[model samples]
Target: MIATPYLLYLGHSNDEIGIKTSRGLAVFRPDICVGEFRHDDCGLTLGLPRLDFAAARDAGARTLVLGIANAGGRLGNDLVEDALAAMEAGLDIASGLHQRLKDEPRLVAAAARLGRTLHDVRDPRPDIPVGTGRRRAGKRLLTVGTDCSVGKMYTTLCLARALQARGVKADFRATGQTGILIAGDGVPLDAVVADFISGAIEQISPDRTDGGWDLIEGQGSLFHPSFAGVSTGLLHGAQPDALVLCHDPMRRTMRGLPHYQPPRLDDCLEANLRAARLTNPQVRAVGIALNTSAMDAAQATDLCARTADMFGLPCSDPYRMGVDAMVDLLLAMDAPAATETI
Candidate 1:
C-alpha cells in the first residue's frame, strides 16, 4: 500500500496551534502520527488520525498547504527544511501553510479571539495618540522591541526617566499602537502620540527662546503581528529624528541555554537600516543599545566597540552606559529633514 500524504501547519506556540486545530484548521504534530482540527480558542491539542496523502487525495484534497510564522528570509530556514523533510517522507505537505490557510473561517475566528483577548486584557487602544499628522517641532525618538521579553520596556522607561532627569524634554511612546499598547496598562497609542506631540509643540513653541526634543520608543519586531502599525505610523505621525535599536546579546541555543558569544552586529545594523529606510527615508543616524544577558563587563565593552565600528553608530551597554549618555549621543547626531520643518 502507498503511504498516505498529509498536510502540516507549524507554529511556535503549542496552545495557539492547538486552538487553530480546534477551529477546523488542519494541523499535525510532528511527535504524533495523527492530524488534528478544531474550532475554539481554549488551549488544547487534539489528535486526529494519521494523515494519508493518498486518502486525502482520494478525498479530493487538490492541494496541500503548510503555514508558518517567522519563516521568511534567514530566520525561517529551519521550518522550511523540516517541512521539506516531511514532504520527502511522503506527507505531501505544502510550504508556508499559515499564510495560505489564514483565510479559513476557523483560523480567522481564532485570531480574532486572540486579538480581542489581548486587547481586553491590556487595553492597547488607549495608548494610540489622537492626531494623525507629524509634529510641528523637533523631537527625538527611541524605538524598542516588545517581543523577546528582554527588558525592552524597562530600558525604555529607564531612558525616558534619565532623559527627563537631565532636563531633556521627552515622552515615551509605544512603537506600534496595537500589541505594545495592548500589552501595557497605560494611555492608548493615539493619546500618547497626541500628548507627546503637544509636549513637543510646547517645548519648541515659536514664542519660546529654546526648543527641546521628543523621544519615542517602538515595540515588537518589525514583522510581529502586534506591531502592525509601528513603522509607518511612527514615521507618518511622530516623525522621529533618530533611531535607537535595542537588542539582547545572549546567544540563542537549541538547548535553551543562555550562552555568551559575539553579537550579530552586522545583521542588527543592516536590519535597523532597512527598517528605517522602509519606514522613513529621512532617518539620519542610528544608535544601538545592547542588553548583556550573561556577558561580563570586559566582553560587553569589546562587543560595544566592535558594534559601533561596524554600524557606524554609538553602541553602549544599556546597563553601564546609562541613559544620560544615550540622550547626549542622540542629540549630537544630525537631525532628519522632518525635524527641520518643525
Candidate 2:
C-alpha cells in the first residue's frame, strides 16, 4: 500500500495564522495554485479549488487541517463556518486538526517579524511619558473612526499634507491594529497593536519632534467587534489634546452590502459624536470627511452641511475640500493650555 500526503484547508486571510498556513501549503504543494477571495468589510475566504477530493484520496490527503484563532469566540465563527462550508462542498475536512493561534495579548511580535517594530519593542504595557505643563505651540489632534475602512488613513494623510502646506509642522501616527505600520516602523499588523500605545505616545510627543508640529493619531473604532481595535482604547491609554471622528453616512443601511453608500450628513455626525464621547468625554470639537467612493459633489456637500449643523464642528468633503483646509479647521479649534501634560 502507498501512503499519500495530507491536504489542509485554511480560512481567514488577514492575520498571521492564515498567512503561515498558506505559505506552508504552497511549499508542500508547489503545483497547487492558491486564490484569495475577500468580501468588503466581511473578511476573506481562502480555498484550493484546483485540488479535488479525488486527488486528495489518491494522495492520501483524506485528512484536512482547519485553522482558527479563538475556538469559541466571535473571530472563530468565520473559521468554523469556512471549515463546515468546505466539508459541505464535499472536501474531506479534518475533524481534530483544528489549529488555533496561541493566546498572545497582542500582535506586536508578529509585526516585528515583518520589520515593523514599535518604539520600546521590549515593553508591551501602556505606560509612557506624558508631556508636563501646558499645551505648547503645536496643535494636538486625533483621528478616530466609526468603524474600520471609514477612510481614516486618507483623511489623516490629507490632514498632514494640509498642515504642512500651511506652514504647520505636522506629524501623523496610527494607534490601532493597522496603526502598527507607524508604531512598528513598518512591521506586520499583528505585532503593531501590542506596542502601539506606548510607541504612539513616544512618536507624537513634542520631545520627539520640533516645536509646532501638529500631531495626528489614527484609531479603528470603539465598537468594531472583530479584533476589537478601538481608538477609544488608544485614547484611554494615550490621551490627545483634541479628537476627530471620521464616519460614513450610510453605515447603518448599507452595511454588509457589496457596494458602498454615501452616509447621511445628520446621521453620520450624530454617530461620530456619540462614538467620540465614548473615548474622549470632553472632545473639544468634531469634524466629518465625506468618503467619495459612492457619492458626487452635490451629495457630499449637502451631507457636509448636515454634519456641520448636527455636530457644530467644521465639516468638509475630504475628497474635495483639500487637506490644508482641514488642518486649518483643526488648528482653529485648538484650546490653549487645555491638555494635562505628562
Candidate 3:
C-alpha cells in the first residue's frame, strides 16, 4: 500500500512535466503539497491543496514525494539538504529521479538513522534479459509522441480502457514513475542499461502466446536530443505491431527548453516509424492521439481532422474525442487471434 498523508515538495519545478505532476495530484489526491510551485494559469492549474512544510508535518504528512523531474539525473545541493531535513522529520521519501536516492550516501544514512524508507521510483528490476521481441505473441501497440510530456501516458490509458470496453484483454505497460503509479507496475525505461532497454521491455510484456492487446506507454521522442536514446530504445524494445503517435496541438515549443521547437507532427510520426522499422519492418502505425485540452472545441476538431488527413490514420483527442476509432483498428488487426476458439 502507498503510504499517505502525502506531501509533494516541488522545489521550483515550474517546467511542463513538473506542472503536470502538480496538477495531477488531484488524480492521486495527496493530503497536502509543500512548496512554492508555479505554472501557466491554464486549465492544468494545480488545485491540489498546499501547505508549508512545517504545517504539513503538523498535520501529519508522513511521506514526502519529490514532485520534480531531475532531467539527466541532476539534483541541487539545496534540494538534497531539504530532503535530509524531511527524513529527519520522519517522512519517508519517494523520488522518481534518474539518480537513485539510495546512491546518495548522506541521504541514505540519514534515512536509515531516521528509520524512514527511500523509494527510488526509477530503480530497475533484477535479472532483466536482452530483448528477443520475436518471442512475443501479442498484438502490441505503443504510443509515440512528437516530444516528451505530450500525453503519451494519457493516450495509452485511454486506449487500454477502450479495448477493455470491447471485451478485449488490454494491458498498460508503463515506462516511468507516474505511469507506474497509475498502473501499479512498469520498468523505468531510462534507468535500464542502454544495452538492456529492449530486454526490459521484453520482460515487462512477456509472451502470453495469445494475441491480446498491450498498450505500451511510449517515452521521450526521437526528436528530443535530451532523451532520444530512450525513445529509440523503447521503440525497438516494444516491437509493437501497431503504433499510435501522440501530439499536443497547443504546445508549440519543447517542454523545459524554451529555445527549442517541437518537430512537426507528420515528421515526428515518420521518424518514429522509420526507426521502429529498423527492428520490425512489419510495424504499422494505426492511429494518432492528439492532446487538445488547451484548445477550443472547434480548434481541437479542426486539428484532429487535418492530422487524420495527413497521416491517413484514425486520429482523435483521446481524452476529449474518445479512442473508439483507434481501438477499432487494433481490435480488427487482432481479429483472427481474438476470435480463435478456446
Listed in order, each prediction's TM-score against the native is 0.46, 0.49, 0.73
Greater-lDDT candidate between 1 and 3: 3
Tens-place lDDT per residue, model 2, 126-241, is 44433232233344666666666676666765676677778876665544322322222221222345445434444444442244544455555555544334444454433444
Judge candidate 2 at residue 270 and give its lDDT: 51
Candidate 1 lDDT by residue in tens digits, 181-292? 2122232333334345333222222221144555554544443344434433443444455666676766353112235222354554455555555434566555677787
Residue-level lDDT of model 3, residues 1-342, one tens digit each, is 236656766665646565444445434343344432222232333544455555667777777777566567555685688788777766787777767888888888998788888877788887989876563566788999888988898889888988888888898888988776456468878888888888888788876654567889999888887889888889988877789998887787888777889998778888888988765666889999888888889988998998889879999998888899888788777432422221
* Candidate 1 Cα misplacement greater than 4 A, ranges: 1-121, 124-135, 145-147, 174-210, 223-236, 251-268, 274-280, 333-342
Best by lDDT: 3
List candidate 2 stretches off by more than 4 Å: 1-138, 176-210, 227-229, 253-282, 323-325, 333-342
Residue 14 in model 3: shift from native, Å? 7.9
| 1 or 2, greater by lDDT | 2
CA shift of 324, model 3, Å: 1.8
Candidate 2 TM-score, true structure as reference? 0.49
Clashing residue pairs in candidate 3 (N, C-alpha, C atoms within 3 angstroms) = none
Residue 334 in candidate 2, Cα distance off native in Å: 5.1
Better of 1 and 3 by TM-score: 3
